[model samples]
Target: MKVLVPVKRVVDYNVKVRVKADETDVDLANVKMSMNPFDEIAVEEAVRLKEKGIVTEVVAVTCGLAACQDTLRSAMAMGADRGILIESSIELQPLAVAKLLKSICEMEAPSMVICGKQAIDDDSNQTGQMLAALLDWPQATFASKVELAGDKIIVTREIDGGLETLSMALPAVVTTDLRLNEPRYATLPNIMKAKKKPLDTIAAESLGVDTAPRLKTIKVSEPPRRAGGVKVADVADLLNKLRNEAKVI
Candidate 1:
């Protein structure tokens, strides 16, 4: 089976994101960018499947500007056979991305597709589901564990209360969650070898998908700073304050 893993480049999780002075969007001028953490788990899972001989090939795909090639290279370093980049400068919505991935799926004909449950930047959590809907495939989101059983896959998903397991037939979509697996670091030798790995870039427009924004962001701003807590003289004072000022009572 051939596995396709989709990745996204976003502001590094450790870095503090700032809103632009004009409030148009988040400032990215000098921000450090890296692959989304959840996507790393997806790549690791695919590579593990390949290592186990369950999958023959792992193809990494990313959709975005030219810079996304770097993200694809990171995946290649981790053990993907090759990469495909859908180049576009426009910000693609979840639907647009799913449509583009659908096109790539038709071309690649992978046995399964895996990606992050949600991109950190947007937290939309819609792409994988949309892609499955587009391709008319079964989907398992927030996957913590996956087992290949003959022609079917059993996935353990993280839900609100606990884990839920489901079995789906082949050619399914799986979205990885944080606890799925720890991603391995790309070694220096593998990083060097990644340069030689085949990475083909195709224009997103050539996919014939409308990469337009369905939603508009009026402005981006920092969350309000939390107010300092007050020290009460006793439980009665606390109750009084909570009942009066806080009005919880």
Candidate 2:
């Protein structure tokens, strides 16, 4: 089976975030960036499938600025055969991203596509589902486990009530959950090897799709800082405050 995995670049989770001066977006300048945590999980799952001989080839793809090439290389270091970078300086909404990915799907023609349930920065859980819809293919979202058998895919998903299993035919899309697998770090040797791997760069315009920004960010602001609480001498004092000032009791 040929597997296609889509990865993303986002601010490293450990770094402290600051809102930009204009309050339009977070400050990315001089900040350390890494692959989205959820995307890393998807890449790990895809690599495992290839390592186990279940997948014949794995291709990692990403859509973003040139800086995102680093994240794609990370995916290659993790075991993807090659990488494709769809260069786009402008931020793409979920629908636009899905459309571009659909074009890539047509070119790659892989049996399966894997992606994170959502990107960390935006937390928009729409790309995978949208891509599936555009392709008119089956989708297994929030997948905790995935198994392939005779052109069929068995997916175990985590739902609100409990786990649910479903089966879908080949040529499907699967969005991975956090518990799916532990992402491996890129070793030094693999990192060097990744530098030599083939990376295909394509412009978004070449895909013949409108790359316009569909959504507008009217405003951005920081969440209000939490207020400090006063200490109460006794339960009666607390009760008094709750009953009168706070008005809870």
Candidate 3:
């Protein structure tokens, strides 16, 4: 079986985000970058499946600027066989991204595709579902555990109330949750080897998909800063404030 995992590059989670002075997007100047944490888990799962002899090959793919190659390399270092990059500088909406991925899926025709539940930067949990819809394939989102049996895939998902298991046929899509597995760090040797791995770059327009931005960002602003409150000396002071100034009691 061939497994395709989609990865993404985003701002490092530890970075303190700042809005651009123009208020159009986040200020990325001098910001550190890393693979989206969820995508790392997706790549790790694909690699583990290959290591266990459950899958024959693992392919990592990404869509974004050239910098996204870093994320692809990170996946390759984690044991994906090769990488495909859909190069685009403009930001793509979920639908556009799904359309591009659908094009690649048609060409690759992998047995299964895995991706993060959401990108940390955007927090838009739509790409995996949209890709599944475009491909007309079974989908298991927020999967905490995944196993293969015969031609079927069993997925344990984290739902609102608790966990739920679902079975889907081959050529399905699975979006991973946090507890799927602890992602492994790339060893020094693996990181060096990843540089020699095949990393193909393709133009987004070449896929014949509309890579246009459908949504407009009308305004961007920082969230209000939290204010520090005075500590009351006793229950009487707290009650008095709540009953008078705060008017909550």
- Give TM per candidate: 0.95, 0.94, 0.95
Clashes of each: 0, 0, 0
lDDT of 3 at 59: 94
lDDT of 2 at 161: 100
Cα RMSDs of all predictions? Answer: 1.4, 1.5, 1.4
- Model 2 over residues 133-172: C-alpha lDDT tens digits? 9999999999999999988999999999999999999899
Q: Give me the overall lDDT of model 1.
A: 0.96
lDDT value, candidate 2, whole model: 0.94
Worst 10 residues of 3 by lDDT: 211-220
Instruction: Tell how far residue 9 is off in model 1, in angstroms.
Output: 0.9
| lDDT of candidates 1 onward, in order | 0.96, 0.94, 0.95
User: Candidate 1 residues 75-155, lDDT tens each?
Assistant: 999999999999999989999999999999999999999999999999999999999999999999999999999999999
| Model 2 regions more than 4 Å off | 233-244
Per-residue lDDT, model 1, residue 96, is 96
Show where candidate 3 strays beyond 4 Å.
239-249
